[model samples]
Target: MTQDWNNIPTSHQIPHTRFLVDYFIKLPTQVTAFFLTHWHYDHYRGLGPNFQQGLIYCSPITARLLERITLVDPQWIVAKHNNEPFLVEHVQVTFLDANHCPGSVMILFQTPEGSNYLHTGDMRYTPDLKEEWKILNNICLDAVYLDTTYCHRRYRFPCQEKTIQRIVDIIQNSIGRDSHSNEIHCTSRHTLYLIATYGIGKERIMDALIQKGYRIYASPDKWKVLQCLEYWDSCLLNDSFTTEPCASPIWLVGWNRVAENVPGRLLPNFEALEDMLYMANYYRNKVNSSQHGLLQRVVACIPTGWTWQGNNREYLQEKDHSRLSVYGIPYSEHSNYEELYHFIAWLRPKQVIPTVSFSSSKRQPKHPFDHLLAGTQVKRAFLQKWLNNNPKESCEDDDKQSTQQLHNQPKIARKGDILSYFKASPFNS
Candidate 1:
């Protein structure tokens, strides 16, 4: 939920249960179990080495991170696998992959009274989510606690793989080499690539470059966290302190070291870039490489969904200075507007409760998917149209239609056709 750091509200508590997800500050006495979605600082803020709270439920990777990074008591932490149903105080709860980070999950709660609730803690919705056990089983949801971080229509961007490829292309092109070639040759000695990242996320970009035979330099603290992840390749990472500064052509810096993201603008952080250039030049001079002059060029790429400028024409935005250039690539771990729309439409939950706040004004902004919720006229009309169009169509006629139109038609023409229509719609694809 949209939590106020100063005073956390009771809205984080699930209905008909004493369990709390991603809320750990000044917890109530009635809390019997704590649920952690991931190892991000914002989600596990109040947890510490001295915490004496009850057991915390999370994924396996997150459990490892807690033991190593936060040093939370291992006795109080319970690790669970994805899609496994377990009883907590006689209530069945399951964890599903949230697809946001290493150990993020979407929690499902089923009570004895036949009520179902889903708490999606910072998730990126994908088409494969439709095949999850809960959705495939067609369980009637009582309420859905959704993550509305990028609920606006302007927040749409390309998929994660596309964005990663774009960043790799930028790096390869800047280094004066063909991206598809196995060999990378750069004539300029002053060129350096900087990738801005967070503590836990953005490993996909690093892994992509590593697969291309590029060495990356990271700090010891960052490397420690990376070792906890299951997919990290230790051969490609270099300890920054032990190795020379210019040993690797690419360096991973903090998120704010490349660009400063404000409300509606992203400006290059010239101060941080200047400091990096100075450090690189100093290290080069110490080693006496060619006894030459200082470096001149540095290219920094900041990957985030906020870089999207609401224009389909501009996938990558650039800003140029005299010696440094910054490129903001639209790489996000959160679902965009269209993804959110398709997910909600397919789930068809009875009621939706947004867990994020988008505005600071007295009057909050309107939700973008309000029209697609239950009981709305738009939903009614869409279901009605689907039922009327495919009432008595024969199997041969359905096969005769084009694949695009066939995806729009339901698989079976039955009494309650709305469910089949939604299940077979192109949006789910």
Candidate 2:
């Protein structure tokens, strides 16, 4: 999770740009424009119905959510299309689908000074992003303000599809019946499925479940949020809990209502389990006894990237009580370690500024992902190749000046000091 250090000016502001991405709290007076990457609460912490800041730029779907959920003034929101280049304060800006959620985007800023920067609010590194980069003619990025939520080496998990499939299999196996079978087996025990999710995102899981002919029950608030998504119509969602338990066996709950991760162990919320049991019993009594079986089983699945701890198992299942079984599956929307490494290597940006970390001060010295940066020699080679291919007036003189400045600077023994070298080189311009 990215720490919200509202006091850190550099953490929110893009270098040489007046725009701010995903920084709403404690709004800075110098900000020329505000950009929202998605509708997630963390990204729009300080935004509310009374938000009167400068125009907020985002995708159309996100714009709708901001108006419907946050109740922000529609006049203040500017909906930009993906891959469309527009000018903000004479700086060319474009939005690329982030592949993280419904309307998430990676903002690209290209200045007239020939400098480029990418601010990835939060992204799941996929082939689609690589294809998007190719469409931009593969311009060399000067810096990338990255979403380092899962930058650590321990965060390698299966892709979203595989994880969702595993979750489906777990639910199917727990129900003790084939999902494709048409015949219904009458038993004394009833199974209740619970999925934990945030306000937005993770709708893919619900969609997958609905595709398999399962009815989902969601809170009114959650349903309203889902209605803003493009795939809302396809979901078989019921907002009222007055229906029979078996009618919509799958229920969507808050993230913490399912399970909480402690330092050394995972603890299931027994109160939630009791509430599920109570609901099951109440529904069973309200209807004919022969119409439905007793609700005897409760299965809770918590999908998150943080649950993976270098284990080969698809999910960690624990039965704290005979009636309840909680499974923590590795389903994350953020880029994992391998994804982050490959992305940075592919871009080979001159400087990498991590956007997510425990502390802003920890970003400078002994950064956890410092090793992911391209080495000085690798950057130099890439720069030489780029300059040779895209020859421009004064290119040679600029290269020579940068090299002379590097040579004139004091000797530094750090081997892979790309940031330090770039700071001293004229290429920084």
Candidate 3:
């Protein structure tokens, strides 16, 4: 399971992401362990007290972050690092850096039956990640659980570097306009630039801003989380920031206010960001027209892959006001359709299953895409290639015998399999 919003471990009535966790509690599913790919809330939020089935594992950094933020104890979440393979109930599990977010990982599991499975948890395929997967050439991958968040044809985006440059350009242009404005009565006022960000996953953009000498300000809780990330990569953030909006040129705003558009002007935290229109009105009312010029302008930029509308990257404006501007940049944490296609081609798994899925109407992987087509072509190609490579194992065999074949096949000879095959293996101990 990748990500589930509900924290109910026992309740089977939840999203598909929690299916495995929920199923384990209802039956003797023989689930030996629960593995977390990253510290994203959707991935680990459903973990409740009822989860006593197996050992839970996450990366060292993810473990630290979870412990600090949530009720998960340090002992409950075992810390695993990249390239370290451990055995649990005759299954060999290896962790690799996901290159998506801090402490994100991809898992490789080799069963005693000699079937190999690779599950990429919320990853962006990079050159470094490509190099890391080279270690798996010795073992053939039977199946791959891929992150196909942007599997559609329209999700063509440039590299992360280009997106970063685009973001920087937007900020610079806004500042340049303010600098070069020819107002008769000019006042020294700061423009409120809000960058919409989730809890994690935009550290690179922050690093770029920090490099250009901009301090990041967020809620106290989020600031603590940023501090934890800063401990790992010093360039990712700054030590100090102010909560006051006018004090900083750039503010890291949470997604709740802008996304939900919650009413009553109540911010979640004392320093929480509220509606930009409301804030703009507050500033506008306080402005002294007789004394000087414009008081403040609020600009909100959302960095996401859904910026393209009919093959062009443009900003879609809100209806209420002109001062409150929202721009979507072509920034993404997951691989696009072309990248996903190429990644699948490179891995050449016998079977490929998308780790993430969406309803027919909802294109929001996190947020909605302008035009989302269920790109069956990529999957068709994979299926065709897989069928060509392994003719003996047809789709019929895949449908009827895949799970049973994996479990019931003759166990490969190992040091402890003969002694502890039926009983609990000594690997976890």
Candidate 4:
């Protein structure tokens, strides 16, 4: 299983098999191994005391990170380099670097019966990646477990570089205006830049901030993780606004804080309640005197892909008041519709299973192969071939018939002639 940390099984419902990748659900079964895709909390949080039966497998970088987080027993972590193939219970598994986050990987599984499967664990697909990962394009896979987060037609996100540059532009523009407006009191007043980040996904954004020479104020917990991850840049500091009001420009906050309607409101883990209230009140009073007063107080920048859902644009503009402002930028780790299509077109798997459950069957479009397909794309060419191969039954019916045929076959073969067996089933070896 991949990305199933949130689905912890209760005592009533327990899984039998124990091979998992990045999912930490508790079960009664004996664990074979824990294959982690990355070091994200949602993916790696299953490493609790209740489930410690198997060896933990992850990339080297992710292993180093897990050591600092204090989630699971670090003694069990075994770092596997990318592209190295390992054997586990007669299945040959290989890992390839997934360009989603640091240490994220695409796991490929090969069985002894000459069947191959690929699981893309939260990745952003590109033409260059397709070209470089030759195994993905060269072989025909038996099945593909795909990341369908943005598999709908409406999702078209800009490249990561462009989005990062735009965010930097917004911060720098605010700083430039602050320097001009508060020149006389610049030494006394400071701008509070609230960067909404999940612990690991936005490291690239942090690198960008460091490149731009912005000092990021990190909490003790986040600071420890960052230090263990070896992000020993000069820009990361430990100074709160209450301690030095004019000290830092950027304060690394949480994702929940960015979704808040009011800026400078006291968030639980981001900062002190009194400090935030003082900053809010101080900026509200200073708005009349300084042109960049709103910028000086607080600006909430949320890096997420949900910017395209519904009326987010209107909400962002409406929330832009005197003290606090909210902006959502398109910075996603998942592949979009076009990328998913390209992956399907290239690999041409026999079956495509979505990692997430479908929302509403009524909301989805219906086609001839609606029940068989995974995403919105109606693979017409594949459908035509499938229909030609099985003319009497639909894909679902064909699956049922095949399964029934297997069950009905004799378990023990009588002394049958090899020639007769070969002639009876030409496809069989």
TM-score of each: 0.79, 0.79, 0.68, 0.69
Question: How would you encode candidate 2's per-residue C-alpha lDDT over 157-238 as one tens digit per residue?
Answer: 8889998998899776645433575323323446777888888888789878766655566777886787788767544243
> lDDT (CA) for every model shown?
0.71, 0.70, 0.58, 0.57
Candidate order by TM-score, highest to lowest? 1, 2, 4, 3
- Give me the displacement of residue 21 in model 4, in angstroms: 2.2
Cand. 4 TM to true fold: 0.69
The top-ranked prediction according to lDDT is 1
lDDT of 3: 0.58
lDDT of 3 at 34: 69
Q: Which stretches of candidate 3 lie over 4 Å from their true place?
A: 1-30, 48-53, 176-189, 230-246, 260-295, 318-321, 361-429
Taking every candidate in turn, the Cα RMSD to the unseen true structure, in Å, is 8.6, 8.2, 12.9, 12.9
TM-score of 2: 0.79
Cα lDDT tens digits, model 3, 278-384, are 56445445753343333355567677775644255475564335445566666888887567655664565655555654334322232111111123234544677
2 versus 3: better TM-score goes to: 2
Instruction: Residues 237-317, candidate 4: write the lDDT tens digits.
Output: 432112232335566766665464222122222233235536644654655444334323556677766564422242243
